[model samples]
Target: MSEVYGWEFSDGPGDHFAVTADHLFAGIWSRPELDLRERRLLLIGALTAQGQFDVAEIQLGAALRNGEFTADQLREMALFLCHYVGWPAGTALDGVVGKVVDQQRKSEQANKTK
Candidate 1:
């Protein structure tokens, strides 16, 4: 089976949405013309462009964990976003991506220790 995170949110008030999103991501999102990495990048860029920092943070971490994007590539994407989305939005995205990278690194280290 494919790995999916964020369904951990399924025990709370948002369970319905979390399950629905899981289904979409594992099922329909995989049948698209675009590849997984490209789709991830699109979602990341869209979320960042809209200044959806919290949601983007989760996705950024997932993207990194899934090997869809490298930390350097994410930073480069943020710079690309800056030109189109304005400085403030891009700067906010940078902060979120940085946090997600740190979280990903810690998660990797923790897994290694286990």
Candidate 2:
């Protein structure tokens, strides 16, 4: 949660939602089938299909951080996804991927400076 949002959450207000989400994420992530990269790709596909660019943005950034996919690869994947998700959603996905790629590069540069 903190990694996704770039902030720590207090176990005070709205704690139930966060706690529930934590448990759900843990359960899903702990399951022995697909690796994180595979799961992330599936999630990106679902989110993009639904036009959920905001959440997809988070996933994209995490993918870059985790070295799951390169920007070029993601862009290529988005192009391939266009046929299945339709051009509109696929275009949106491409835009978010570009945004995340820039953000990741900036973050890496900042970390190096520090």
Candidate 3:
């Protein structure tokens, strides 16, 4: 969750969501059935269906950062899924992909300069 969402969470017992997330990370995500890349694709598709581009962008950015997807591939997925999701959602996804790719490239460049 932190890797994909750039989130920090308390390990305290009081944080129900944090505890649940930890369990999910340790259990569900560790299953060998579907790799993280495949799971990310599913999640992105679902998010697109719901017009949840903000969260989708987070997933897209993480996918790029983790080398799970190339910028071009992400863009292509957006274009392809737009047909299933509708024009407006697809357009939003395309724009988000562009933004995430640009941000990722900028971050990479900054790292190289250091």
Q: Candidate 2, residues 49-100: lDDT per residue as tens digits?
A: 9989999998888888878889999998789889999999999899999999
Per-residue lDDT over 1-114 for candidate 1, one digit per residue giving the tens place of the 0 to 100 score: 144333343333667866876678667677768777777788888987788988888778877877888999999988899998899988899988889888888988999999
Candidate 1 C-alpha error for residue 51, in Å: 1.2
* Model 3 C-alpha lDDT versus the unseen true structure: 0.87
Per-residue C-alpha lDDT of model 3 across residues 67-98, encoded as one tens digit per residue: 88999999999999889999899989999999
Better structure of 1 and 2 per lDDT: 2
**Which numbered prediction scores highest in TM-score against the true structure?**
3
Q: Which residue pairs show collisions in model 1?
A: none
Question: Looking at candidate 3, what is the lDDT of residue 73?
Answer: 97
Looking at model 2, which ten-residue stretch has the lowest summed lDDT?
Answer: 1-10
TM-score against native, each model: 0.78, 0.84, 0.87
